[model samples]
Target: MQTLPPMLNLNDLRFFVMAVTHGGFAAAGRALGVPKSTVSKRVAELEQALQARLLYRSSRSFTLTDAGRDFYEHARASLIEAEAAQEAVQRRVAEPSGTVRITASVPTAQQYLAVHLPALARAYPRLHVQLEVSDRMVDLVQEGFDIAVRSHFAPLPDSGLVQRPLAVEAIVLVAAPSYLAARGVPAAPGHLTGHDGLLTGVAAGTWRLSGPDGARMEVAPVPRMTVNESVVLLGAAMAGLGIVPLPQELCRAAVASGQLVRVLPDWTAGSVTTTLLMPARRGQLPGVRATVDFLVNCLQPAEPAGSAGQ
Candidate 1:
């Protein structure tokens, strides 16, 4: 029969090492933030467990026996190794270096992450990412994704997932200058009845618009074409096919380049909030957390210039 080695109390080993290094139990207890009596009792228990006397204490001095000296050297080495092990684990937890799996809608992946992720890779050279772009509402846990970028018009339900709002993008009606000039700009929600509409998503035909004075209305525009893809709808609008309501971020570059113009400047087709979602458990990992913060910083709309210090 083989015998198992004795299992030692880690606290006892720690106390023993500290006692020797500090020259006495009292000093060791002070360094360890414990009562000397507690330290002494723990050390005594350690000696009893090991069946050996580790220290020789007299009225004049405290010294180590031959066995104690040998034990001390081994104990000191063990403690050093133990501390190094703990620090290694802690450093892994602190540093962001690992693969992070993410999911985002096609438009979001293109308009935001596609442009920003290269910078993230440059900044954290050791961090790797796997991005899955789809319009499906992915089950983050079941699908094994670390993070998800989602956009919705309403507050997400209580799904027990952690969600961080990245930005609120205004849904604006846009069209090419040629299209607007030919079809004539819709002066009000009612004026959209005759104009051709290029729409996307589930609520393709209907548009919910809020006017300048906080008045809200809904309009069902005449659909020239309806598709679930925003990029395609944007293309159709840019080709002067019709008007389309899209998130401002999607059309920002086109608007800047004069390829598209906002159809209703004083009215908006509601707003969609871009959110960062992650499984509650995965949020604790260093790499996942770092990626979340980085994406949030990159995607969130910047504050208007000169708005600070007010």
Candidate 2:
């Protein structure tokens, strides 16, 4: 068998590099929190392993020989690469990295995520986000999604997924100024029966509302048009098509800008609770967990300092 080279000790290489950069073993040892004798011994071992003199030592003179200069160049480069490798791994462990795939409803993605996700990017530059916008409910595990945003009137069924409630926004009836001008705004839920109704979810459904006096009723209106997407419904209402029930946040700006007006001030169409869902397995990942926490912080009220999730 061919004679194999001696195994090189990484610590010895580090000590040799430090000794050269710090001017001497004593100074290097001070920087390394070790004794000068330990630094000298390690450097000596490194030179012996390489079968080359990497440093000259005497009573009054200390310097690098021709062999030492060549070895130092390669050794310095190796140490730099090794440190860079170490830092790369430490960054992955300490900070969030890798791609996180997320799914959300069309309206939520546009109004909330698109607005807030830029902050996530600024906070963790190493992290990558893949956003999927869909109005239909997605199977988190089956669809291979890391996270999903869903809104429901009732409690979500136990689907073996971790659920985090983001917000509970009241559904309000809104109509364009033109429609309210022509159709007349309904003062009470009963008055909504005849006006042209724009609905979102089903082809035909009731507007469940409760009054300021705690009276509740459901009015099934004949649909002028129906669509499954909330954004489409918002567009229709803004175009003076008809009154549509929408999450308060979805149309707050329109209502503020005088483009649309709330039909019944005291009554709501009901509340839709938005929840963030993730697979139990996926939630355990560092990248996914950080993303979930970031979204929660953005949507919910602020918690006390240091109480933020990991």
Q: Give the TM-scores of the predictions, in the order they appear.
A: 0.69, 0.77
lDDT of 2 by residue, 1-310 (tens): 9998766888888898899899898999999999999999998888777888888898677799899888889889998999999998997798998999999987778978988899999999989999999888888888899999886667789999999988777778899999989988788789988888888767347777776756787787768888977889999999999999887888999999999998887777767777899999998888899999998988893221111010
Candidate 1 lDDT: 0.85
- lDDT (10s digit) by residue, model 1, range 135-162: 9999999989999998776779988899
RMSD of each: 6.2, 5.6
Which residue pairs collide in model 2, if any? Answer: none
* True-vs-predicted CA distance for residue 48, candidate 1, Å: 23
Q: By TM-score, how accurate is candidate 1?
A: 0.69
Error of 2 at 55 (Å): 4.0
Clashes of 2: 0
- TM-score for model 2? 0.77
RMSD of 2: 5.6
Local lDDT at 192 for model 1: 88
